[model samples]
Target: MDHRPPTIKEIARQLNVSVSTVSRALSDHPRIGLQTRLRVQQLARELNYEPNTQAIFFKQKKTYVIGVVLPFIREEFFSQAISGMETAAMAHEYTILFGQSYDDTERERKVVAAMKKQRVDGLIISLAKETRRFDHLQALESTGTPVVYFDRVPPFAEAHKVYCNMYQGTAELVGWLYGRGYKRVALINGPEKMPASRERLNGYIEGVSRKKHKVDMQLVETTDFSRDSTYRAMEKLLSLKHPPVAIISFNDYVHMDAVQYAHRQGVAVNKDIVFVSYANLPITSYTAFPPIASIEQYPYGQGEKAMDLLIQVLNEKGLPDAGTRYYCEELAPTLVMH
Candidate 1:
């Protein structure tokens, strides 16, 4: 009547052999005789004896599990990235432990702590919007846990990171706008503290200079990537003495918010004021007014590369000078026209 699963000790009892012998035979250890191994295998199949994977993983000091943390999975960009990471992890006989920080720094720390408690082999994360201190992340790395940052990475370069180069794409976006006769372009950028925001700002300047147009700080606005914040930014831009002919948002989500605000103000989306953004998310295509062009950051590729880099780091953990090495990969983004 007992429903307990058969164990190696039980098998050893039935075969009148030592537990070690049963374990060795079950594993087909080279030291075990073929006849004994065959007997153990046959009994295991008949008795439905299953190896304890947790015990084996504990003894080997590897869970074969990777932790992934992102700001928001609801955003298609992060969803795509996680899909790529899952694909890469599966190829290596590993699984992913996923968490979302929800753009809160405190929540990010808690999620990281939970992952650490789970004893993950490695971690891939996109920094939260409010994350400023790297103490928690540094603590993880210091404890010999491999950590890889992707997309919204930290400001430092000493750590492993995989990200898209938005600066060049944003610059290209500006040039594209200029070519289409939208000379006076404005940028609705994210918080200035973000590296992504800085890249877009620099790109906007470079693109303006390339077109021989003077940089206009007045035309640029910063937002917290909120609906109300974007609406306020749109108000400020539209109130300018000389409003921009085109507007570039931090990303597709921001682009949608800006476009919606413009529409409410009786402004033609693609006519009176054009919009462009980054991420090139699929949802934008179905929107009533999508960006004329978008920066394709390839979130999925970044996620795959981040996971691959983490696996490499995990593989080289014990090698000489491996601790001192850091891997950084930057992918150049492309401009996709809607």
Candidate 2:
């Protein structure tokens, strides 16, 4: 028994009409008579006819699908962003395929290659921490497939990028700490290679200068944004000859690790040492002793805007104007003081 799904040809043969007529009728072509269209539709329902989407997409020269690449999806921040993207894609009658790289550059490269091979119309990416080279991304662009980068984007790429203004946010937080009479301020930043880390470091320097405070090289420590790294950084900072009265961590997760270390060392958080960091997740508020402040990057809003821009670029014919060849959207982050 060679059982298969019913096709348009079978419907046409049964109705004694041409295959072209059946297709036009099913598509509701204006040239097709209403009587014939209704009859074809009725017969299609009776036969449980299903159109071949692949064939349709091939003829239209569009997949109507987008690929998304992220460092990891387990984080609440990334999950919220994915929700925003899915909402937008649903409204546009499109589907998405996701790939996670787990913060590995080699894995990210391979995932991107797979998406390209799948012939996705466009790509959205939040670069992995280990990603330093842009050759793989550049290769995708050469194929005329548009890519929109969100948080943790490559600094040198000329593609459409959307990210939070971490520099300004960090500067404001630092100044706020100074205003509260915290003289000795310490910073625990992420990898120096990351744009976010570099920007935040510059912001810290600017804030110190703006407050007319002396810059203390001993107070600043760079980490890999890991729990162990942040804990060690916190330990080192507390052991300094003149420990800082306030600390700014890389993000909420890293800040939590530092707080735990402070608790173990008998240092009262938000009392002995004022703490601040980026990523104002809901968990921050539920903590027994939360940080003094945090920066809300609005990950969902970033994702929505990034996806909209990508869709806009996909619809545009030919190359964009010279002045608008590359687009960058920077979303403002709010300083949420607890």
Candidate 3:
């Protein structure tokens, strides 16, 4: 009735009914008999009365786009996961936007807010290393945006995900190291705030501290995922009064960092240090000297699975609010020693 681009008023005049009745019937108010509501709806449809999306927002606002928030996609592992999401999105004909939180809590919050303002219908997220709280993630889900977490999700946070069976890889890697006669092994760990860090550390501890060959707790050095941090941590460990003859690094990325650190310290990688990196990315093989071995967790495959899971979630009318949906794969590892 505001004389804008035609609305219910014109429809009501054509149907010979009060504007209030048209509005109520259009809304399918239960108090108004079903037959009356049906007739009004039928007429509205016939007239092609396009309900103003703004009006709908005024009532129940929703946007159909999706946002994918990642800590950093610089790693090939993340690249694969993103591919999976893109493949699934293409199939569904849905558009996706990306946000890199860069491990800063404030930056992460800003990205989340931006996605909320854009009214994304869903989210696919991998928390930053610094994220210790799930309140922001939970709030978005509460608003009806389906969120599927992947990779480095919080330990206590319940959500859907696709990840690697780190324990399996660790057991295999550590068992091999012990077999190679590297008993006094050391672990250069990643940032404690990261899920992968804890998972990897747990696997290392459980694997080495078994029926045989127990690792020394003092040999473990905590560091960030960056090459510089890894190098620094490795330096501290190597400077130990009795340095470990073998080092099991966090991942291939960190493995490269550790390798470089050893090189700088006038030590040969395989010959002197006997290094092994978790998550054997192709980049690892191309290192100046390939690590003793690396667990080949196919990020490309993981990414594909992530997309598949997201599609399933989007297909479902309503996903369960409680419980978690997780898929973890333990793929074969390749030990390519130089």
TM-score of each prediction: 0.97, 0.95, 0.76
Return the lDDT, model 1, position 150.
Answer: 98
Query: What is the C-alpha local distance difference test score of each model?
Result: 0.93, 0.88, 0.75
Enumerate residue pairs that collide in model 3: none
| Model 1, C-alpha of 271: deviation from truth (Å) | 0.9
Q: Tens digit of lDDT per residue, candidate 3, span 1-338? A: 56456588887887788888888898878777888788889877876778776666557544445698887778787777788778777777666788999877779889998998888777878888888888888898777676777766667635776677676677667778888788778888878778888877888888787737656788889877877788789888888898988888887777877888888889977887788876667776566877767777766666566666766676663558433454343344455444
Task: Return the candidate ranking by TM-score, descending.
Answer: 1, 2, 3
Off by over 4 Å in 1: none
Listed per model in order, the count of residue pairs whose N, CA or C atoms clash below 3 Å is 0, 0, 0
For model 2, where is the 10-residue window of minimal lDDT? Answer: 315-324
Error of 3 at 255 (Å): 1.5
Query: Model 1 over residues 1-338: C-alpha lDDT tens digits?
Result: 99999999999999998999998998789999999999989999999999999999999999999999999999999999999999999999999999999999999999999999999988999999878899998899889899999999888878999998888888899999999899999999999998888888998999999999999999999999899999999999999999999999999899999999999999988999989889999999899998888889999999999999999999999999998999999999988887
What range of 10 consecutive residues in model 3 has the weakest lDDT sum?
321-330
Best by lDDT: 1
RMSD of 2: 1.8
> How much lDDT does candidate 2 score?
0.88
